[model samples]
Target: MKGLLLRWLILTLAILAAAYLIDGIAVAGFPSALAAAALLGILNALLRPLLLLLTLPLNILTLGLFTFVINALLLMMVSGVIGGLKIQGFGSALLASLVISLVSWLLTTLVGNEGKMDVIVLQRRDEDHWE
Candidate 1:
């Protein structure tokens, strides 16, 4: 529980920093930033996977680039849900989403993993006879 909360806190800070970078992804202040983070998380959880699935053909057609547009749309939808958050237009949304993705990827890389969780073993270490 504590670890989960801590991870959420880290994510909140990342989102706040991202919103700072993007002009239209504003929150009134700290409180609003936190609220926006929560809203963003909820939307991503509930909507993102579905959107990805629905847009799979388009995503493949664009060699995965269309996923960026889908992500931007989700971010804009988040702004719609949260009062102080706003993404001006699709172009702004696309730019902001790219910025957010870059920042979040950097932060996640810096932080590393804190627990055992669900994920594919994309690469496996070579095995030996009890070595």
Candidate 2:
């Protein structure tokens, strides 16, 4: 549950970052960003799989790049439902989606599944063996 909340917060931050970086994406405030993130998460969990399966051929043809289009559509849908979030057009949604995904991915990587910062250190215990 804590991990879930952490992930949600990360996504909310990502949404805020997207709003900050993208010209056509507007988030009214932090509350709106939180709501948008939650809705986007729900939609991604509930609807994305079906959409992906339905568009498998196109997705395959584009070597999975079409997933970005699906993501953009979902972002647009979220904006439509969230009163405080606004996407000017499909192009804006696409760019915003890219930004959101990138930010979310980067933060999530830093905060691993356990909801803590993950760091790896490598040391050479011996010339022949490293651990």
Candidate 3:
């Protein structure tokens, strides 16, 4: 449960970052960003898989690049559903989706699957061995 909340917060931050960086994407405020993130998560959880399965052929043909289109479409749908989040056009949606995906992925890597900051440290125990 804590991990889920952390993940959601990460997503909210990503949305805010996208709005900040993308000219065509607008988020009313933090509350709006939170709501948008939650809706986006729900949609991704429920609808994304179905859409991916339906578009498997095209996805394969495009070497999985078609996933970006699917993500953009979903982002546009989220904008339509959320009153506070606005995407000007398909191009904006595409760019915003890319930004959001990148930010989310980068943050998630730092946070790890358990939603806690993960760190790795290496030490040399001997001349020929490291631990």
| Local lDDT at 90 for model 2 | 94
Question: What TM-score should be assigned to candidate 3?
Answer: 0.88
What value of lDDT does candidate 2 attain over all alpha carbons? 0.92
Name the regions of candidate 3 deviating beyond 4 angstroms. Answer: 120-131
Task: For residues 1-131, write the lDDT of model 2, one tens digit per residue.
Answer: 89879988999999999999989989999999999999999999999999999999999999998999999999999999999999999999889888888998899889877877998888999898877
Runs with alpha carbons beyond 4 Å of true place in candidate 1: 115-131
- Model 3: residue 2 alpha-carbon error in angstroms: 1.2
What are the lDDT figures for the candidates, one per model? 0.73, 0.92, 0.92
Residue 41 deviation, candidate 1, in Å?
Answer: 1.3
Q: Candidate 1: TM-score? A: 0.75
Stretches of model 2 off by over 4 angstroms after superposition: 120-131
Q: What TM-score, computed on C-alpha atoms, does each candidate reach?
A: 0.75, 0.89, 0.88
Candidate 3 lDDT at 10 equals 90
Instruction: Estimate candidate 3's RMSD in Å.
Output: 2.5
